[model samples]
Target: MVLNVDNYHLKSLDNLDVKCDITKVRTEVIFRQSNEKIGHGIIIQSKHFDRVAVFAPFSGIIINRIYSVYVERIPRDQQWNEQESGTYWFVPSNQIPELVPISKYSANDRELIGPLVGVVVSKAIRFAFVWSPSLGEGICENHENLVIGGWIKFMAE
Candidate 1:
């Protein structure tokens, strides 16, 4: 759980209702199924998010962006630190393929965006992605969960 210490309150994301369809639908129907190509991912935030690509839910390798979000902070340190930080991931929209408008979301919605990486040590979340030898990866609705080591990726490697 690379949750922001000072930014992104979890409640802002929990049960965040976005108008997915113009008409209303059951909550169970919306998230119960994996909605095809729209997989989930963790939101990695900074004072500024750079070189980030915002793909259209359908197109790929698009040079231009449909939308972009930028935040500023002390220079970003892409290095792998010994301390356990949060893992980062990208949630792709299955139907659109390349279209994922994370930037279009308000700060609260962005906070809800996170990769289902192993376990989240923070208290704000309930769902987590746990690792297993047989299952590879699975979701567990538990907070303060820790992800097993040796599964995450860093730019250094």
Candidate 2:
């Protein structure tokens, strides 16, 4: 499956009925172009096993994006740090053949987007894409319940 970020608009969560699981929350500090401190990138996971969704604690435009793939099949002793290895091979979104407009994705390619990359939304939300041989690729924001609602709302627009 492939996901095309260009197809969606970044909507504000003020009106959304979603509730983030604060207990599982993780955060990363963000900085502006001027090197000023901005809000943290808040990551909230769902309690339900089947759902995934991520929220932007603050708003900003996507400044950069990189596709990450893991080479973990290699022996553990031979494996390099997952972060360095995965990101080292990251191709820019523009360079990726799969990161196209949503309408351009075939049925099989639709879900491929989740595991391909991390998006840096300037001073906003940043997502880290991780891959596992057993689990395949999925967006970090895997909220089954909220995903359906969000997708429905996103599609309606």
The true-versus-predicted C-alpha distance at residue 141 of model 2, in Å, is: 38
- After superposition on all C-alphas, the RMSD of every candidate to the true structure, in Å, is 15.4, 18.5
Tens-digit lDDT string for candidate 2 (105-153): 4434223323212221111133323222223233433322222112211
What's the CA error at residue 76 for candidate 2, in Å?
11
What's the C-alpha lDDT at position 118 in model 2? Answer: 23
Candidate 1, residue 113: how far the Cα is off, in Å: 15
TM-scores of all candidate predictions against the true structure: 0.21, 0.16
